[model samples]
Target: MVINLAMKILIGIPFVFGLLVYKLRTRHLSTFNAIENFLRSQNNLMPISYSYSDIKKMTKGFREKLGEGGYGSVYKGKLRSGRDVAVKILGKNKSNGQDFINEVTTTGRIHHVNIVRLVGYCADMSHCALVYDFMPNGSLEKYLCCKKSGIHSLTWEKKQAITLGVAQGIEYLHRGCDMRILHFDIKPHNILLDDNFTPKISDFGLAKSYSNETSIVTITAARGTIGYVAPELINRGIGAVSYKADVYSFGMLLMEMLSLKKNLIQNTELSSQYFPDWIYDHFNKSKDLEIGDAEELGCEERKITRKMTIVALWCIQMNPVDRPSMSKVMEEKFREKFNLVRGGFYTDEVQGS
Candidate 1:
């Protein structure tokens, strides 16, 4: 009887181990199928795919990390063509890997200059990653708020250009694409600067797409980071959520860009200051705005600063209906360009939108 019992116990061990192995393989296969199905439906717009081994070789065994954020750790990598790329290996999957699908589908079809391009991707079960052109300047957040003492402040011209670049990028997401993409997150941290300082919007993991005809979309919960999320998103009664939510976020970003330079040195600011309210009190007067560099802005520079400030205020209005559409917001830029051709400054008319 003892010999028979031992034989049965040894057989059960292998049977249970085999069963676990089979279940693990099946789980991985299911995830692979889900990713594959999404890619298959995207026509030919999807970026290149890399195997797990290729990822290791390109990233040099993940030796050089570029940065880390909510999504995952990004490592500097090189493509076969000798071009540099940033590979973001996503964190372990706790859900169905919906964020991976969201990013691939959202950015794969976009061909805008202001939006970041997805060069390739990997969906190797637990080792999924995204590849993109490495922005030499990194994120705009590095420059803003003077995170470190030695980091130089951006010039007014460059600051305005970044503001306009981000505006155009958000505008493209709202109007340029077949489906309106509402980038729920539009903070400075997500804005990447190339070697030329041209801002490219990145990290579309939290983005949502709706038909251009979708004026007011529904969601189960509010999206976007805490500081930048629109009022209507959190409270249903605030207003119907739409592309306007992105406008609200862009407005908040503009506020940060404007106030960051003054934040460190200015001692007169109120305790627990909300920038919009503080800036509003000081609006209409260039010196009162107190945008650093001794508040001694040149004529043209002052006009650009005020132009963006006006746009920013318009964006964060309490009611979504009151906020200007990106189309209306961007329309003023065309007029400003026309004025420049006629030797006129952007001027106060930029306030109309």
Candidate 2:
């Protein structure tokens, strides 16, 4: 009887082990399927997986140098199909694998004239890269900071157009997406300009999604660039950071656009301080409105340029609520005269009152 009992137990052990293996395999497949569903819902056009070898060849071992961002350095390259692409190769030392995935998946879903397009990505565990439509003019940062050599200086009109485009892009991300996308980080470096000087918002690694029903989500760590960071980030803890933070960043960006100077050190004065505040501080004065030298302007369109500056100040108000929505910004910008119904500067409410 003892021998027979041992034989039955031995057989049962193998059976149970086999069953466990099968269940584990099934679970993994199910999880993969769910992830796939989420990607589809986000309108991702899942490009075929490309190996690290393929990318290296396409970029000629990353020969053509483009500018670098927080995550990685971008290289201009040509694909197998004679297509031009901007390849962002993530640094092994600086960023993580998750950031690459976020940049790819978040940008892939977003399709807008004002927003940059993500062509594809490479995730080989060790080598990470992001492919995007090549923008010849490069980033807005180059113009404001570097002063492109021998190139025609940025006209006041061009800057106005760029500002309008960028505002519209942000507005679209907030309201147009299936889920509201908070850029979290908005700066001149992230704004890429095409051949025609159209602005496209890029770099979505830090982007977060929220629904209209939910407000004030929790975050453990602080994220975003210096100077462009909203006041809420410094005073309150991480969790308090909200969509309004993005508005503050936008305001800072506007200040930079007008002053044509790096406003981070100046913006830190707090309470809509720095260039935007300075502009508003002197909006009533002719000299202040002429921050951008008229000589830089090709045409004698002074009145219109002054109005654009006022709109930018409105965007950078101390209170997030006082800032106009991206859509409203676009409408008011193109209009001959923008009567901001919500009186001058609201420091209490994040959105314009």
lDDT (0 to 1) per candidate: 0.78, 0.70
**Which residue pairs in model 1 clash with each other?**
none
Task: Output the lDDT of residue 43, model 1.
Answer: 80
Question: Which lDDT tens digits does candidate 2 get at residues 1-353?
Answer: 99999999999999999999998666645543544454445554544456789888889998988877567788988888998899888876544345655666667767899999888777564667788999988889878874534374586668778887888888888788887788888998899999999999988888888785665645666789977877566657322566767766776787677663443334445446554455444443433334545564544456556666566666666555556666666655545344433324443322442
TM-score, every prediction = 0.81, 0.74
Model 2 reaches what TM-score against the true structure? 0.74
Candidate 1 clash figure, as a count: 0
The residue ranges of model 2 lying beyond 4 angstroms of the native Cα positions read: 1-43, 46-48, 94-96, 146-152, 237-240, 260-290, 295-300, 334-353
Q: Give the TM-score of candidate 1.
A: 0.81
